[model samples]
Target: MRSMTLGLLALTLASACGRNTPRPAARADAPPCHCSHDASAPMAANQPLPDTSVFQMGVPWTDQSGRAFDLASLAGSPTVVLMFYGTCQSTCPLLVRDVKRVEAALSPAARARTRFLLVTFDPSTDTPERLSALAAEDHLDLSRWTLLRGADHDIRTFATVLGVQFSRVGPGEYTHSNLITLLDPQGVVATQLEGLQQPVEEFARRIEGYTR
Candidate 1:
């Protein structure tokens, strides 16, 4: 009779143990076990950028308005690009004037379609405040103009791609080749004018062609 009671007690204990044993916790690195769709999650839907475009460099830049963006953000517009230091006394001002001349030559419709980008080699000095001051002094139309500043390495890489050569000739001065580059909507170099002497009308026509 005692052996029968012992057997029944063992069976009851075994059943209780089986029911009470907890499952192991999941590992920290393991992926989530989701059972339902996430409606608020963002979908991966971006197309790959072209390999040859400069925007593919993924360099970060800050503009005169203290807004941060990558070069790819300017991808869809026909850009008039040039590199200059804000404190430059010689060719830099001439370059700005030449770009303005091109802007002046554009019709209102064409001007609205074009974007002017000025990247500074002297990022250390050309902070957003300084760029804003310069823009105000030049009466730059902020609606269509963007002044950019990035790291020194990024500046060098940008100049190299545009075939612009620049060096710090003295304190607060830079000696850079006066070249203006026009980029198509795809960020491909459509045309490059080597000096400030190029006719503004020709440059304007090139930009207009791209807009059309």
Candidate 2:
């Protein structure tokens, strides 16, 4: 009976060990995002929607022109902020391709009124010179797709607020989220596209909503 009891205890301990998992604490963003707004909430089901573009991060950094820029930037018109590295192997290119597609679909007047901001996460490698070259290679209009850089801390902060996720595996290589954020002229996140699988028409529609 003692031997049986010992075996049962060992089995229970093994089961408990196998079932253990490190649970993460509730994050600040975990709570449903709500504010005192007369409009509507930005959450649908379990996901966040940009009902109002009031979210802004004041983190500061520099632009491709080597001028100071910040997350709380005020664009002349509403803007679409995108994240990518010059040396990205996959998703980044797809994002740019989709943006171009959207641009092509836009009316000449709409293209003139909207803006795009590309923030580089790998700022150490993507200096102003390299960013310039990459922009040229992609035929990016500096007037529209403005490239920006930030130090690691501020860059991470900006990425977090935009919900852009990334992990560096080696030098100049990263696994990152394929996301694009639409910010209104007032500098609020109007909406965020979490994946690149959506149609360019979808992005165009989203952009129009923000422009209004």
Candidate 3:
């Protein structure tokens, strides 16, 4: 009777052990809790970066110096392009200031590798010389900064390709996105920085990475 009782007890223990297996504890390698990005988040990274989207530079547009410039000439390398109007009192200045901040944040190595390109939607007014002055006023180093202009048609075309939108409000005043687009060495847009709130660190990282 004792031997029979012991056998039954061992059988019950073996059955319980078979039913339960030890599980590994939760760890950092575990998948993050599933979550979605904000539905209303800006469409900043919506598309794959391209080498060169679309640019029209060869056509005649008066620069600030009143000399005609061809947009095609500025192609080939990575560019940080932004859209602007000369007479804007709001975002344009701030946009330039933000660019200046990015410039100041770059290491010497990055300074030599990247270029800042500004194209004016208000081609009628932002002559090359005026644009040059604007760059100087904002403390932009011309060694790597190139301001270009195109006829209204070319400007519209460039903006369309860049997905940049600007609306003219008053004589010389326009409301536009404070955007900075990163183009790869081939002229394809890698990313666009929308809004001035993004940190200069982010700018440096994006520029450094894209240009690299």
Candidate 4:
């Protein structure tokens, strides 16, 4: 069953993340499905995670604060998740900035209950200390944002679950898909915003519904 779940997800992602061309900046007119869930409702607390939940990976992780972390603990709050390395010279900086824009757009009520999770593709370079330093450099609100790294295999598994393709292109460098995903309170992927430099108002609005 687990293998089947992963297989189906891989197929779904092949279409979503396989595109070589950059997806266009998100517009108000963009398809609603981009910010909507395939499931009709969030799962109840006692319910097992659906096959689509990334939290199903059950991998051990370490956060920027150097604390051991569990992915499932993120349940019960909406989370914004993305994958990137700290030192990338190209799209990573812009991707982080775009996520911040969405964060800034959320109302305090919504923002308080929301979490931002940034996991690194290059775990060897993005140690907890380095992730913390990068967070400080970006002025991330530590109370809400979490930067995480894990063992290489765990990182690969987690990336696969999120449909984020990444590869080490050179020493200290990686190429990765620019995908921002929103997980519902139950940790099921509710929607995604792809590409870079996209408008964030609609994305922010979609997230607000989950917070409330």
Candidate 5:
């Protein structure tokens, strides 16, 4: 009878030990828990740019408003690009007018998707204040227009990339080729018009095509 009682007591202790033991923790390789969308969450990586994009160059630029930006910042929109000095007498005014004409020809929807970039070859004289004054004088639509200036070396490099030739003709004067280039959203050269008074109908059409 004592052996039987001892056996029962041992069985009871084993049960108590089993009840006190904890379960194994969750698996380390378990899937992550789902959560609702959070505006403050970290952003995903940006999409890769095309190989032939001009934004591939790491050139820095400053706008008429004194804001600093790079070519990459202008991505995701069709751009009308031209190089001009702020103080030119002969062809610069005509180039600006041609750009204005192109802008006017764009449909409202296309206009929204289009942007204009004017880079100054004479950065020494075309300070932000001077560019701002020129923009105001020409009644340029500041909302969609950007005037840029950079270091002389960078300006030369950019001109070379665009195949634009320029040489200093006089003090504060430059003789540059009259070329206006249209870049797609990816910064690829889509079309180039080579004259101060070239018809903008085709250029507008190309812009509209890209925007669509």
Candidate 6:
């Protein structure tokens, strides 16, 4: 059972879309993407990543503090990532709480080296100011948590890299999968958790292993 769970979650990290994935409207200006995934073998910490690393993308981003950010800069630490918009009323809030639980489970040493990254799907609405407000409202520690927005095309590319499916269904409305990915120090996925209201103890233990 444990192996099966890990295998499925690993496939998600390798960018395997679910069978019922929604067909989002295509963007004419979106860049060509050649996402790759190899879940045939387990990844080790601190190794150099392949061309398929999520950190390989060079898309520019602006953080909640209105500072320029790079995906590659998160390379040297364990990162917990969630793709979400600030104004989401339903699942996004629950997802945020889930991640907060994961944070609370970590020891001070582990938490200090770990970072939480939130990327918004609705970049236009989730501007730097709004993201900052959301973080403050959530009472997230700025030093360890980051909220960022990028161009739509870049956001799509990044989401594809992580196998996070999302589509704008209505005005200020988006339907997306609830995914939490753990990236190793070298920016390769170490594990992933999907869905909501699930126990995060296993996820927390896996992260603690990487810190040791």
The TM-scores, one per candidate, come to 0.75, 0.70, 0.66, 0.78, 0.77, 0.77
Local accuracy of candidate 5 as per-residue lDDT tens digits, 135-162:
9999988889999999999999999877
When summed lDDT is taken over every stretch of 10 residues in candidate 1, the lowest stretch is 31-40
Off by over 4 Å in 6: 1-48
Query: Which 10-residue window in model 5 sums to the lowest lDDT?
Result: 31-40
Worst 10 residues of 3 by lDDT: 33-42
Residue-level lDDT of model 1, residues 95-159, one tens digit each, is 98888888999988878978899999999899999999999998999988999999999999999
List, residue by residue over 51-156, the lDDT tens digit for candidate 6.
6567768889999989999978876667899999877989999999999999999999889878999999998899899999999999999999999999999999
Candidate 3 error regions (>4 Å): 1-52, 55-76, 210-212
Better of 3 and 5 by lDDT: 5
Q: Any runs in candidate 4 off by more than 4 Å, and if so which?
A: 1-47
In candidate 3, what are the lDDT values of residues 1-212, reduced to their tens digit?
64354535665666566447432322233222111232112223334323344433245655555566554444444467778876777778788777767777877776676777778878678877788788778777777877778767877777777767777776777766677876654455556777775777865775565444
**Comparison by TM-score, 1 against 6, better one:** 6
Q: How accurate locally is residue 158 in candidate 2, as Cα lDDT from 0 to 100?
A: 77
TM-score leader: 4
Model 1 alpha-carbon miss at residue 148, Å? 0.7
Task: Please tell me which model should have the higher lDDT, number 4 or number 6.
Answer: 4
Error of 6 at 85 (Å): 1.0
Candidate 2 pairs with clashing backbones: none
With candidate 1 superimposed using the best TM-score fit, by how many Å does residue 68's alpha carbon deviate from the native?
A: 0.6
lDDT of each: 0.77, 0.68, 0.64, 0.81, 0.81, 0.80
TM-score of 5: 0.77
Candidate 5, residue 169: how far the Cα is off, in Å: 2.6
User: What clash count goes with each model?
Assistant: 0, 0, 15, 0, 0, 0
